[model samples]
Target: MNTSGGAAAAGRAGNSDALEHLARVGLIALGIVHLLIAWLALQLAWGGGSGSADQSGAMATLAEQPLGKPLLWVLTVGLLALAVWQLAELTRKVPGLRSTGEERKKAVTGTVKTVAKVVVYVFLAITAFRFASGGGQSSSGQEQQTVAGVFAWPGGRFLVGIAALVLIGVGVYHVHKGVTKRFMKEIDAAQTSAGERRTIERLGQVGYPAKGVALAVVGGLLGWAAVTFDAAKASGLDGALRTLLEAPFGKALLTLVALGIAAFGVFAFFRARYPERT
Candidate 1:
C-alpha cells in the first residue's frame, strides 16, 4: 500500500521499446520540419517573399503536400510520443548520475535541456494537429501579437524580459554545444561507423551554432521589445530571420544559416537512426 512505490512502478512501466521507437519517429519528424524551414529560409534569402520561416511555416508547407494531412497526423503522433518520453525522464534517474558536485550539475543541466525538448516536441505536435484538423493558419507576425497580449498583463514587460534571457541562454548553450562538439553526447557515438560519426559531427558543428545564433537574435529582439514597450519589435523566429535578410550582406549570411539548418535536419535523421540518447 505504498503510494510512492506504486508511482515509481508506474513510471517504470511507461518505459518501453515501443515508446523509444515512437520517440525516434519524433526525431524524424523534427528533421523534416527543419529541412522545410531551411528551404523556407533559403527562399527568404533569395526572394524575400512574405512567408513564415518558423515551425508554423514548416507545418503549413507540409499541409500543401499530396498526402499532407496524413503526414501531419504522423508527425503529430511522433512528436507527442517524444514529448511523453522526455516528460517521463523528469521523474526518472540518469543511469550514471550520482549525487556528487559535477555529477549533480550535469544532472541539473541535462534535466533542463530535457524539459526544453519536451516543450518543443509538444508545441510542434500541437501545431501538426491543428494543421491536420484544418484549423491551422499562417503564423506570420503572430509572435508580435502574442507579445502584445502579454503586454496587457500586469508586469508583463518584466516577464517578457525574463523570457528573452531564457531564449538567449538556451541559444548560447546550443552554440557552445556545437563549438565544443558536446552535441556528440546527445547521440550514441559507439553505435555508428567511423564515416557516419564524422558526418554527424560535422552536421552538429554547423547546425547547433546556426540554430543557436537564430534563437539568440529572437531573444535579443524580445529583450528590445520589453525595454521599448513595443511588442511589434518582438516578432519571434520569423522576424529574426527576416531581420537578417534586411541587414547588409544578409543574403549570404542567411544562405549560410539556411544551409546550417539543413545540416541540422540531416543530423536529426542520424539521431533518429541511433536515438540512444533519447
Candidate 2:
C-alpha cells in the first residue's frame, strides 16, 4: 500500500480533468472569436463591414445575433476557466519530470508565460462578461483612454516604450513557435490521428505567423506612439488591421492575413479536441 505513488497518480488523474474540459471549451470560444475577427477583416478587405476588426467587434457581432447574449455568457465562463487553468498551471507539475537545473529554468520560463496568459484570459473573460451583461464598452476607446492615462503618469513614455518592446517580443515568440512547430509541445500528439496532426501543423504554421505579424505591427504602432507622444498611434488590433489595409497591395495582404487568422481559428478546434497534456 504505497500511499505516495497512489496520491501522485490520483492527482494526475483527477484534479485537472475538470479544468482541462473547461479549458477545451474555452479553446472553442477562442476559436469562434478569432474566426469572427477574420470574417470582419475580410469584409473590411473587400468593401465594408459592420463591426470593427477586433475582439470587441467580434463580441458585438455575437451580441447582435440570435441567442447572442447566452452565447456570450458561455464564452465568459469558458474564458474564465482558461484563466483558472493558467493559474493552476503556475503550481502544477508534470508527473514524471524531475526538478533538474534545466527543468527548473524551464519551470521559471513557463511560470512567466503562464502569468501572462492568465492576465490575457482574465481580461478576455471580463470583456465577454461585459458584453453578456449589456455593460459593454468600446475596446478601442478603452485602449485609448488607458494610453491617455499612462501619458499623464511620470516617466509614462518610458513605460509605454517598455510595453511596446514586450508586445514585439511576444509577437516574435508567436512567429517562432509557428515556424518551428514548437506549438506541438502543447498538444498531445498521441491523442490525434496522423492526418489530424498534419492538418493541425499546417494550420498553425500559417496562423501563428499571421497572428504574429499583426501583434508586431501593433507593437510598432505603440513604439511610434511612445516616440511621438501620440496616443492615437497606439490603437490596438483593430487599428493594426486597418493600417495593413491601407498599405500598398494592402487588399491582397489583408485577405491573406484574414485567411491566416481563420486558420488559427480552425486550429483552435483541433486543440480543443486534443489538449495539452504535459
Candidate 3:
C-alpha cells in the first residue's frame, strides 16, 4: 500500500469537502431567503389592494423596498464565486489522468459541470448588472429600476429561465450519475460496510430528487413567465411562490414546495459533508 497515494487522496478529499461545504451553506442561505421573499410576495399579492393596486403583482411592492438591490448584488456575487470554485476544482482534477476507467469518467463529468457553472455565472452576472442599472423607460420617461432588475424584460427573463432549465437538467443528470455510477463504485472500491453504503446511497437518492425538483419548478415557472411576457410574475422566490399560491389549491401546494426546498437545502448540507459517498 503506497501511503503517499493515500495521503494525497486524503488531501484532495479535504479540499473537496471544504468547497462542497461552502456551496451547501450558500445554497441553504439562498433557499431560506427565497422562502422569506415568497412570504413577502404572498402578503403583497393577497393583502388588500390600495387605489387601483394590483395586489397579485410581483414587482408592485418589491420595487418600493430599499434592500432589494443589495440582496440581488449579494446573490450575484455569491453565485459567481461558486462558479469559480467549481471551475477551479474541475481544472485541478483534469490534469491528473487516471488509469482506472471509472476515474476518467468522473473527471469528464466534473469538466462538464465546470463548463456549465461558468455559463450560469455569466448569465447571473449580466442579469444582476441589468437589475442594478435602471432597466427600461418609466412612465415619467426616466429609467425604471428595481432591486433584481428587469423583472419585466421578456428577453432577459427568457434567457435566465433557459439557463435555469439547463441547470435543472444537469442536476438531474448528476443525480443519476452520482448514484448509479460514481458513489456505488466508491463503496465497492473501499470495500465499505453495507450499512455505510446504504447510508451514502440514501443521501444521494434523497438529495438529488430535491435538487432536481426545485430547479425544474423554478425553471419552468420562469420560462412560462417569459413566454407570456409576465417576467414580473417570477421575479424572485417570493414572486415564484406567489404564483404557485395563487393557483387552485395554491396554498397547500406552496407549503409542500417550501418544505421540499428546505429539505433540499438540508440534504445538500449532508452531501457536502460526505462528498466521497455522494
1-278: candidate 1 lDDT, tens digit per residue: 88557547646644777888888899999999999999999999999555699989989989988999999999999999989888777666453255778777878887888888888899999999999999998887788999999999999999999999999998999899899998887789889999999999999999999999899999999999999999988977888888888889999999898999999999999988987643
| Model 1 / residue 40 / CA error / Å | 0.3
For model 1 the local lDDT of residue 58 reads 89
The TM-score ranking, best first, is 1, 2, 3
Clashing pairs in model 2, backbone N/Cα/C closer than 3 A: none
Q: What's the residue-level lDDT of 224 in candidate 3?
A: 65
lDDT of 1 at 267: 92
Candidate 2, residue 277: how far the Cα is off, in Å? 1.2
lDDT of 2 by residue, 1-278 (tens): 98567556545543477877888889999999999999999999998885688988889899989999999999999888888777666545443235778787777778779899889888888889999999886676666778879999999999999999999999999999999999888788999889989999999999999999989988989999999998877988988898999999999999999999999999998888988775
Q: Worst 10-residue stretch by lDDT in candidate 2?
A: 89-98
What order do candidates take by lDDT, descending?
A: 1, 2, 3
User: Which prediction has the highest TM-score against the true structure?
Assistant: 1
On TM-score, who's better, 1 or 3? 1
Which digits, one per residue and each the tens of the lDDT, describe model 3 over residues 1-278? Answer: 98557556644653675555655544443443333334443344456333111111222233345886665555556555556555556546655545458887777766776687667555544454445454511111111133126554556665655655775575577567545635344233255466765665665465455345445555565566556655343433334455566789876665555544444444434343443343
Q: Tell me which residue pairs clash in candidate 3.
A: 37-238, 38-238, 131-149
